[model samples]
Target: MKRHARITLLLFFGLWIGSPEGWAQTTESGFVPLLNGSSLEGWEGDPTYWRIENGTLVGEVTPTTLLKTNTFLIWQQQQPADFELKGIFRITKDGNSGINYRSERVPEVPYALKGYQADIDGQNKYTGQNYEERGRTTLAYRGQQTRIQPFTQGNVRELVKNNAWTMLTVEKSLGEAEALQSRIKTEDWNEFHLIVKGNRLQHFINGVLMSDVTDLDTVNGKKAGLLGVQVHVGPPMKVEYRNLRLKTL
Candidate 1:
């Protein structure tokens, strides 16, 4: 009887320690979905430009016959300091689309008119790179020539894909601008990750280090307002976004 009781006590202690650690590990490592798979519960934007259809967030350009206005699908949940954002996006037409971060809120102006933009283009002319707001040109691709020459006019034409999903990422440290990473393959799914620390930024595409620019000039100080999706007005176009998630550091 004494031996059996001792064995039972030992087993109980072992299970208690082991089971709690396993449960705790799962909880800590679990990923919370930013988009709830049905509607834009935590997002705010113009209805004419952004909407959720079939679990994908769609940003559509109005018809050319309609009036033109700069509209954005802005994240209602704002992040100020360091954070990492990942998303899967696809452009249906050959046009412009971008993920805007560290942006300030202007009453009617375009969201990116204030912050740094991680630009992706479906047109085959510009490189997928970093472009500062209505300010001086920062880091850009070295070997390739942009379609819109002079680089500051903000005409991007590289890494743009039609009917394909493209992974994009941007990391911004306080008072520093992040660097541009490599171009992932289009027509299939890819992964992108970014890390931002004080005055230092790193970009990764498919587990490869693409850009590691540091000591960037301050554009909008340490903290900014919101994250936004861009739908440049011109010819009619549609862009779909999914798996959008953010982690605050």
Candidate 2:
């Protein structure tokens, strides 16, 4: 009887160790602040567009400074492989921007990056989509859980587009896109979170899961690269980011 009691206690302890509560405690810690909130110290970008204003990272475009191409403000510290990033962002009514991760720089173009982007816009039309900049284009739209398959001639009928470059198969719908968009506050601060591990990428907006993607196209998918925030080529607008934190996994 004592031996059975001991075995039961051991099983209970083992289950507790691997429980959701245990994982939550560990995963919630170890976050390090990425922004100083006072200056752009560990970052690189076009001086004309990126700056720190009143303790917030700001990117602005005016009538005179209309951009011919998108510009990015890159983090110079490290190119994280598996990590979780959390930050708060606000933009004007017509602003368009995104957070780029596991990306590479375009040497010919100043402050340009190409990789996966957590798309953001003032209209909430694409506030939480996974877009591959200068690559496969849209990997997953808002409220989607998608798998990116390698482009092949055999699956041409199932392809999303005309070419092999765009082959995203929707595995399931996470939620209604309009319902998810309602969680975002326009022209106000909204939280954005990203969990990137291996080929799986998940994006959340305002603490709600917005889009998820599993990239199987190893030939075109990126595993590790730089981190950046973009100021897309558009009308006069402003965007601000704060409380940028990262926890490497």
Candidate 3:
């Protein structure tokens, strides 16, 4: 090839290799941002509660604006299946919210989601837990390695002995809840990480592995769905999120 032609090809691949979007789509841990930091582009939610303030995605509720149900601000760009998500969160003393992945939106309720949620709260008791928004609820608490076993009777799904759809067999493999809680920063921003690969999911906060789950429930396993942020309905609360990034595997 000619010298100029080789130079042009080199520049083209160099740009592609360094591009964030291109890298995120093809490389592990190459993050592509979900929040633009200045505006609410590529997201949908109830403007009454969700907004961007000071370059952060803020969800606030007042006593007068109490919500009847949990609401979500959903991402419109992608419905990720196997991926890693990262963000920074800050919450008030009363705040309760989470990042829901592989979740389906509720048709009856606006800005509602029902699926896997990496739970977050200011109390540190709930943060880093694996929760299903409207499904099995608490699949795994903080500091646990849980195994979900689901049994079926012929074509019908059989409930577990407790009448629950799946039997939760938990192994306290992770560190103590208090130890994981120590990594959390209340009323201040903390790093959050979530990984979902096939029927396995993991949650981490401030570099601590909070929970891990091996989902054996074939009847209710989520392969791919919407991604959303939650704002629970309760006392006056506020939660701020920033640096939303994702890397698909």
Candidate 4:
């Protein structure tokens, strides 16, 4: 090949390697696995709802052991800021779960987190949205690029009562919600990725951008806290996670 053609080819491959899909392939280099698969060594949660099965981290809510509130399996290693988390998850059809980051434990509630979550559900309705666990609520829906603004001065109490600590503006559309949902595999294993740096958070599913949020609500936004996975309060279901890894930026 000519020298110019060779240089152009190299540039194309370089760009590809820097893309999100490319990051999926190379992120393992700097990431540390969060789970040991054989035991919950650096984790804490209710033993009744969380365990290890077939070398996978499992959280299940059985019919006889229904939960009154969502429960989480929290990683006790560290609370990472400006980091990347990636893992494989599979949930039963009736299941709902999420990966929480920059989160704090609910003081009065056991095994509860109050921060940002990369939402997941067996139905895929909210598979890639950014939802605050017990704080600002929905910051960005699937296929949305949103900016979260601080609350207005008027009726601050009412806003807080309404679970509206922040305001959100959809800056752009990433894609149609249904189109993005179509990319998710139902009741099967899927790769979930989160890139959180400063006040900007982005979620990806199977290398596809599902939601993006630039949080400007410094008053309510969190820079860092705990890392956890939850099993929501609902019917009997099972959620499994494996290959849990994190790379702090």
Candidate 5:
């Protein structure tokens, strides 16, 4: 009888030790949907400029309602430290938009984001790059694996920007920026992938590596902030995003 009791206790302990805490373990590592197909309950933005239509998050800039500055639709739920974000996006001609992570909400600008942005343009020109909004524009360009070094000049914190802000050199070039041009579907949906961990950031489009940036600037860099979607300031255009998913690690 004592032996049987011992066996039962052992079995109980084994089950307890082997069991998972919650459904997070038993299920596959599924990505959480940030944008619900029906409503924009957890998001904040300008109603006239942003809305949900046919299950997609849509942003539009019309001729009469031209924007003076770039604006964003921010996710109010959470601010992820290390994560992977992905979605399907398609923009019209001259339309430009971005996925901004670790970004600060500018109350003065009202829906403007000020931090690292994953840039994409309608002309397929600036797609797949790390851009610092209002801090340092164009931290890394397409097909670039870059590292930023402090500029030695007194009180000058960042590396110099020659006329344009594309001075950061590429450490490893997986492919050229032009290589991704043909790969991006102009009028159709294109997949965007962004991964951020520690001080490293990488951007990909349509399964191709676009740019990588290693941010060592601690004082100016952001460790945690909100995620946002951009509708750039320019001519009238429309952009749509769907199937937005995020996974934190």
Candidate 6:
């Protein structure tokens, strides 16, 4: 009877230790992959401007471009109210590329016509700033020609590098007030992190906290929709994006 009791106790302990919660704690961290790296199987974009080349997502621009057939690589997965997005990008030359969040497709207008863009322009004197799509210009700098306001000068300066991989992160929140922010580091491979919830937003670059802007009036009343990558049409230009990833909050 004593031996049986001991065996029963041991069995119960073993089962408890091997329960799902114990196993899940380590495997269920927040990090989730947005891009599968094999193909654009889950994403939709204009074939004319977006493609996966050598495992890096490439967005190309050409002269004499028209609004018709303009391409944007969109995340097929829809997000809820709160989440974070991070990615790495490299711009080959002077052009424009931006990350669009909470965006919807308007057949007659540009993809960003209703979303917020963590704006990118290698040629612009002020790069890596937040701009409200089809809304008020939130930030602007570098003379009237290039403008950035909400994001700090240090944040933009740190995130962007000349012809090198730079980390980019954008965070948004829907709490008491709406907000949006971003950061970047120059000339080195860095990490970009963003947090979005309610109407508040935060941005980080290579683990450095950059901006914390609030009171954002995002499209669609702060709900989540599609995340997109943009390649502005202009003189021939190319941008490479890889290790694209995201996680929900």
lDDT by residue for model 5 (131-219), tens: 88777788887878898654333433354364224435568876756776778888677888899999899998888888888877676
**Residue lDDT tens for model 4, 1-249:** 999998887675542232232222222468888887699999999999999986678999998999999999999999998999988888998999999999999999999999999999999988999988877688888999999887545653455434433467899999988889999998877898899999999999999999999998778789999999999999999998877889999
- Among residues 3 or more apart in sequence or in different chains, the pairs in candidate 4 whose N, CA or C atoms overlap within 3 Å are none
Name the TM-score of candidate 6: 0.63
Pairs with steric clashes in candidate 5: none
Each prediction's TM-score against the native? Answer: 0.63, 0.84, 0.83, 0.86, 0.83, 0.63
Q: Could you tell me the lDDT of residue 103 within candidate 6?
A: 64
Give all candidates' CA lDDT scores: 0.52, 0.85, 0.83, 0.86, 0.80, 0.54
Clashes of each: 6, 0, 0, 0, 0, 31
Runs in model 6 deviating more than 4 A are 1-28, 63-71, 110-113, 124-126, 139-190, 216-221
lDDT of 3 by residue, 39-138 (tens): 8899999888989876678999988889989999999999999999987788898989999999998888988999999998888779998888777777
lDDT of 1 by residue, 1-249 (tens): 699998886675542222221211111132345677688788777777777886678888756433265456778776646777666666644656667666666656644345555665554233244554443333433122122212222223332334111222223321212322234544333445555555444445555444444433443333455777777667777777766667777
Against the true structure, candidate 4 reaches a TM-score of: 0.86
Question: Which scores better on TM-score, 2 or 5?
Answer: 2
Hey, what RMSD does candidate 5 come out at? Answer: 9.9
Inter-residue clash pairs, candidate 1: 121-160, 122-160, 122-161, 125-157, 126-157, 126-158
Q: What is model 1's C-alpha RMSD?
A: 11.5
TM-score of 1: 0.63
Question: Which wins on lDDT, candidate 2 or candidate 3?
Answer: 2
Q: State the displacement of the C-alpha of residue 139, model 6, in Å, after optimal TM-score superposition.
A: 4.7
Candidate No. with top lDDT:
4
